[model samples]
Target: MTRYQPRHTADVRDTGRRLLVRGGAAATVMGAATLGLPGAAQAALPMLRYGSRGSAVVTLQKKLRTLGYSVSTDGIFGPNVLRNVKAFQRRAKLGVDGIVGPNTWAALDRATSGGSEPDPQPEPSDPKPEPSDPKPEPKPTGSRPMLRPGSRGSHVTYLQRQLSSHGFWVGSIDGSYGHLTSQAVMCLQKTYGLGRDGVCGPNTWSAVGRISRPRAAYYSGNGIEIDLRRQVLRVVEGGRVKWAFNTSTGTSRTPTPRGTYRNFRRVNKMDYSPLGKLWRPVYFYRGYAIHGSTSIPGYPASHGCARVSNAAMDYIWARNLAPIGRSVRVY
Candidate 1:
């Protein structure tokens, strides 16, 4: 005769405890193994950017050095690390945002584990692939509607991509033609001698296809050059215009001083002066700076400081493109 009975509470508790201990031990082993391998550890790593510090930064620096980048594993994410990250991102064909997010970390893992070469300075034009033949221009189809602000669709996204590929910053390709898209279109129009209507019409599309990289007046240094007449800003690197952005300089009442000056000071947050609020100001002269502004019209509208879109200023900050002591040439 057998008496069927449920397991006692103590027995169940003991079995549960044993399982928990075994699971924790297995987890500990897995964690140790993951930390031993770079690629495996990347999934649990946090994003590293400027000003980040700790053991994670050390890991990033070590991985960067492994990929032949000259970065010190001092557990500090400084300007040098930011530059190396940008260079690596550019090399990996990823967004050159200088932030070691998940995508960047994955790219680093692939490059290091796959036995890729060192971080060689790629040609400026390597990222941008130009068509071999410029003769056969892209004809606009009838279905291509004229893009204006507030238009939302894939066509607007295509327009944004084209403008970005042409080196005009359109903020983001969100499939919506917003203010930034309109501003970029106006910049393209201004560059190609087209009418600055801020509308993407047939002529604008044609110019987008035919235009080449805009050249800066001062092509001998790494700095920022502002074309007052064109209302455009050129970021020059190694004597080439790496990027161009639409800017609004000082109005006629108070002109942006025309001279070559190094960025003597900088404020990463919104700065208040007697004139108005300036976002992330990079001061070149006594009171004038290249700052982000809420209102950056196509013409000279600022009181004195050069005004660019807030997003553009952020891009400049992220890349350290206009660091302290960097030259700023205004003409």
Candidate 2:
């Protein structure tokens, strides 16, 4: 079972709005270009950048934030905002294709005022398929949702979209948690040394936002991502954030937990031992660990121990921590 988390204020609402309005989909607001010409060009908003600092980004961010998207109006298009966008898109049932196109814009317009959800079912305009002389190339394998930030829909879709923004492709944003999404999620878990289950919950989303920040590094085929606000751990690897699980810290957990902790050890596969004080085997470190549990339910679940899934334990066992001496820090 994979855990997930949300990264925004609870006051936020899921008002599915299209961010883009295409040429014939809605009324147009045209403008003229330079050279003393009228009606020369049409104006459209560009794709929002992550952690962007500007008026446009701020306006968009505030709007999204108000609508229950976990994005900040910090004038920067950060990971949080991207997650928000993906959430909005998903709820609207628009293509989880991640791009902020006309369909997205139209939805956004309705979302701002707490409007009702539009019908996202595919239209049957039935354009005739053009015959191609050359055969089309085979599509890529693996199902990663093309979801972007601010899409509206189910929590699962929301989680998948957030993961995609943080460099983990979870397959087509079809609102289904299939194998491809799970594989991408596992990649994130392996990188961060978390249990490699493919479920997206509060813990996983928190890790996704944190890893997007600076200072997250890849170590000996594994990595860790820390969320300052939520105080959790996210495993990553091979340029993708793998899995996210909970952890515990020292009595004076504040400053120490703030910094990143690199992999120091990996405990491998073991037989189920009821005699042990754990539901699963333990992976020990200097004084901490990434292990399994039968009682971990929420944040601060371990005694500075990084609790992970049994699968994650097995993965680390097979793949030793080659970067055992890397530094972990907090911001």
Candidate 3:
């Protein structure tokens, strides 16, 4: 067995919420776009910027306080308020001008209150021939329910729905937990920095609650998307993700370059200097390939390459998935 140290972090943002739990606990967790529109009384809230003050400022301050910001909710626009606003702006990837105008207000409203997640991407084609599973009814749980291989129920169906909604192949929605569903759940667990236990529990359930759909590079084309954050390598054919693989990408020191690239060379098998051996290596970036590893951890561990399991790499080559001239996108 490939041995690598496991590192798990409780990345639940102060504002990020849990999945399934409702009531007052719901306030402690998140729902999709719950913050999208400001509160009912926020329609008249003024555009706030540096030096602006009054009830509108109070509204912004209260929103910030509710979002776990350290700023006071005193309704006075001050240095503290500006700092929190700018930080929120940066975290949300909105304009960093610190001005709470229409755009900023809209973004802040859409911001995740706790445990921030990526915005949902456009839904891809259904991976299975059958109808997609219906959404599961939510309920509070005493403890995080763990769904592993051999598990079966409506929850399994719900889990399958979550995976397919995010473009991962869960095989089918028959509510039977099997290898394919296990693989899909593993990919999802890996993507969100959760433990690669092939078990869907609270953290995974919460992650599934907030689906981050991956997009193709251009408006339309067959391509490969290597998402570092999601740790997924998506095979995009005709501008939609047809398949996905859990990939272990580069570390912080040797980060994978973010851009569009193409396969330039390949090797059936090679014994690299420190990497030992790479299988079905298809090179795109310098020395970096969508290759195979006996030990593809859930997190970033490679020097700079995108790595899948040996079998997955074989599947890619067998199908001529990453032929020369095909786009490989890392974003």
Candidate 4:
């Protein structure tokens, strides 16, 4: 319903309205529940206050974000969140105690759902010449032409359609490779550790084809597993893979640990020592974490830290997929 480049995200509800793009459009992946209002995409919304974390906090952050508030939806409600809540309450004329009670949640729901802002109109282009040259340049003949910015057609439509189906929002499916589509493509590229060139090429297509969700396993609760054999990270919840993303693990010399661990801490943006700039890091061990990266190759490559695309990491944060104390089986 809205489009934005990641404020560095620029974030949902539940009978959980899991917005998985299927077919040529976004098919709402719904779970068991009842007839309800919007916000089903998020699992649920609980009362959030200082020191709160998890999906509820994520939902609150997203609602605040959609209303033009600058807050990181990292699922951690620290002082920044508290301050934002107070600011919002002041604006809404509610009690300004910084506690998100029923009133705050209701106002957030109303604000985000009140109406739709029209998509920005494209800038006027230079006047074009008459259609004397009908044939024009020859189209690139391939199973899937390498799509870049300024490209358009049914093929573009197909690409856009497929992207949206995989939960990557490319704005609209109008068969136009505009900025929104480009951002989506960039995200997709980063998800699998491909070059962040925003071009839908062979590698991107392969990753797209390999897109899948995780399946139930021995674990009975929420956790994350990085399959070395498959080079993918599975987001396991309640014995089922809610979502999956392509990943590039550590190289042989600096291999990842093959054991069960728990996410001990989280940093919304980490640049301490050797970690570099981890957009949203969920630490499963000391130093080693599943973090967003700019250079994620199909093959193993990190300095022992399991790597995911920045886009994938952003989704993880936006959805609170891997909260602290969650199981992380890396085998």
Candidate 5:
């Protein structure tokens, strides 16, 4: 799937409006069908266009390439690709409109199914270095270690930039692996079930590269706003409130430290109380959380953490985003 990044400066309002309408239409169909209405017009639903690598586009690209067309298998839809597709359509005596419809798909399917591409070149292998008399120095602890862009030995920094572009928060991408970067890496790693070491190794890099699809949406510099007086947490993305949740702050000395903190690790089931029990851990730093509260009738009651219904906690966990050190502004 193409990764969708929010192009804040782009004129996509119209496109979004169209999508909204389409989504509404789809909803209407579902609603009608649920009521036992017939006439949903399921067949009239348009075939979704897959630009590249996806099932449809991949089929088109492969067929074109098989017929000795000079287009890379990269899943981007550009003029060159469209031109080649048009040429193929012409040669195949198809619609010749350059668009791949069901007819074009049938023709291409017949042409390339018999033969496949040559084997891809094997990657080069590097032997591990022999252990030296002096062992390597141990890396530092606390926060995460990341590299700065344009710095020597900056592979980590470059990786951070890529992750940032893919909507993973890594704190400024300044190259220093601090708490934010580590936290971001951990979140991504957990999501993908990779080792949560917070280090961008080969596996992590491969995953990051896969995020080029949809162009990798990112959070704007607009900060997260918390209204302590109102006891609400407002999530703002690109200057808009994506969501707002009612929450309970701290009380007395340990009163929920009301300040900005980026979100990090997330646990669906975690143990709080230092005694190591089972509870879900949400936001990091100070151990304050947004979790189940049977007793929270309203107002401040948590030791310092935010108290939300278990159901709300699940929602927050799913939408929980703290790209290491993403500002958690509390006021």
Candidate 6:
């Protein structure tokens, strides 16, 4: 008979097993592809901007240094880094957003590969006059921009650093012109007998250049002095004004006691009194404490207590500046 011989059973089983194995392999690969496996899971470059801080910032700073940018690799993307980044962007003919994005990264890489010279550092329109200069030069309004509560960028950082150097507390040296900066500006205005508008106008900038560290009225030892006339508080140590804060003393109805007293009590948390909420109060006299308040205006607006910002009060608590047995002098 011409009938074909039956295929071997073992051969049939082997062929089926091979097909199954190939099918399973294909399924696994397909599944991996569907789930975006190994190849597609690689991390993309991060977009870095101002206020960024971390290993990524360090890497960016290193790359900037390789391109001869004069930026400190401190991992903090502050004003210096922002300025350098803007300069790089301008050189690359990219948008000067001060943000290190993919395009900026590519430009930096291309520039480094080509070994291009670093761009010239940006010159300030109105260079800050030295504090020790006998004649403080006036920065004309036409050259300098007026900075208010919403203003931002390197200029705000400059203002913050200037205020800090003058012993005024403006919270952090961040570039954002927030409430603390406004309060510090107001304090400066009050000290210089300018209009307390809390805006850095031409007159305010003039005052900033002329402002100097205030001398403590009481040069005995470590003490807290509140100048009601200036609406400022000075933390004196070793007979020198260590730090100053914008403070609001009592109103006309209830004026702060003008005397020297010892801080007998300290309330670490919020204290509810008949007048209002007192945050981290350091009581110097009867119902009169140098405490923190939310409404510390440029002028007197408190209820017989020297009102400072809540952040200032926290700083006092942290440094033990206003502790029990500390002298409190009000003038």
Q: Who is ahead in lDDT, 4 or 6?
A: 6
* TM-scores of all candidate predictions against the true structure: 0.60, 0.30, 0.49, 0.47, 0.32, 0.59
Model 3 scores worst on lDDT over the 10 consecutive residues at 114-123
Better lDDT candidate (1, 2)? 1
Can you give the lDDT of residue 229 in candidate 5?
A: 57
Where in model 2 is the C-alpha error above 4 Å?
1-229, 236-264, 269-285, 312-331
Q: Residues 1-331, candidate 2: write the lDDT tens digits.
A: 4877655522222211111133332323221222213332223455554545577677676555344333434677665556556766877878765555566666776666557652121111214332231333222322322322333345445555555545443434444554445544555554455654545444444455455422234444445654533444555565444444333332334222444555554333333332234322333344454554433333344455444433333333323322455444433
Task: Please report, as a residue range, the 10-residue window in candidate 2 with the lowest summed lDDT.
Answer: 11-20
Top TM-score hit:
1
Badly placed stretches (over 4 Å) of model 4 are 1-154, 163-220
Where in model 1 is the C-alpha error above 4 Å?
1-138, 141-143
Ranking by TM-score: 1, 6, 3, 4, 5, 2
Which 10-residue span in candidate 5 carries the lowest summed lDDT? 117-126
Over 175-263, each residue of candidate 3 has an lDDT whose tens digit, in order, gives 66765567678787766678886788777888887767656655277889898987888888887776677788899997878898999
Q: Rank the candidate models, highest lDDT first.
A: 6, 1, 3, 4, 5, 2
Model 5, 1-331: lDDT tens digits are 4998656633444444555477786655554444334443232222323353454455455456445443545666565567566656655667767666666666665555542221111001113332231323223332223332223235555555555544444433333454445544554554455765656665665566465311111235544555555555555666544444445567665577766677675665645664123246556455655454533333565677765444334434434433445667766
TM-score of 2: 0.30
Residue-wise C-alpha lDDT for candidate 1, range 1-331, written one tens digit per residue: 5998665856655555565577785554455443354444765678888999999999888666555344567899997688678867866788999999998888877666654533323223556563233233245655557889878766776776666665677755445676667877888887887887789988887886676778778868798998888888888888877778888999999899999999999998889985579988999999899998767787899988889877678667755779899999999
- lDDT per model vs. reference: 0.75, 0.44, 0.68, 0.65, 0.49, 0.75
- Give candidate 1's error at residue 227 in angstroms: 0.8
Cα lDDT tens digits, model 6, 274-322, are 7689988989998889887778887899889999877667657755778
TM-score of 6: 0.59
